[model samples]
Target: MTDQVNANSYLDTDSSNICEVLQILGAKWAFLVLNELLRGPQRFNQLQRNAAVIKTQSLTDTLRHLEQNGLVLREVFPTVPVTVEYSLTEKGSDFQTALKEMNKWVEKWGKPQQVNGKTSISS
Candidate 1:
């Protein structure tokens, strides 16, 4: 019989600290929301329409999570009707640079593959 071992057991270095940051950013719909806000501030409806992949409740939750993590800034205007807008904070801007770098890495080393019966790519 062959010995069973966990893949992570072979790695020598610990990345638990970095994993926490990744965990926050790696949530579903988080990156998409950030992408929408990258260009400029957007209203809730705009983001909802742009990210059709995300459910409204999930998007709202992701936005709150980003805001709590200092990656998004929510602004409220007191007019006849309330106007709420979301923008990337300075921290979020820095995170965008990191995302760009990640994109570059994927472009260089990733290849298209079939994942879960769906065409996808990985780096």
Candidate 2:
């Protein structure tokens, strides 16, 4: 008799780690907000302006989640009305290396093509 392979056999630790990371960054606004912060610290208004397409509420929620995950830091100044600024934590800054690698991978193997009004990546 021939041996059969299990379809689920490919699941492994690396896949689990990737899945967990995606869960944290997969939100519509999370990566966008993080990318903006990678430039440096900025006030809420500045982030909203630079991110352009993100709504005020969505930006607020994304910042809150990033802060909770220790990927961002929120600071408040003792100003008249209270000023706030957001910056990436060390953990967040470390992600820049990974981003660079992903960008390189895209350059090498991620040619985009239009298909029925949608875009798709093809090697």
Index of the highest-TM-score prediction = 2
What candidate 2 gets wrong by more than 4 Å, as runs, is 1-11, 112-123
Report how far residue 64 has shifted in candidate 2, in Å.
0.7
TM-score of each: 0.77, 0.80
lDDT of 1 at 56: 90
Tens digit of per-residue lDDT, candidate 1, span 1-123: 133344454342247756777888977888889988998999999989988889999999999999999999999999878999999999987888878998998877789888999976685
| TM-score of structure candidate 2 | 0.80
Query: After aligning candidate 2 to the native by TM-score, how far in Å is the CA of 97 from where it should be?
Result: 0.8
lDDT of candidate 2 over 1-123, digit per residue (tens): 123234344456558889989877877898888889899999999999999999999899899988988889999999988999999999989888888888789877898999899987753
- What overall lDDT goes with each candidate model? 0.86, 0.87
The stretch of ten residues in a row with the least summed lDDT in candidate 2 is 1-10
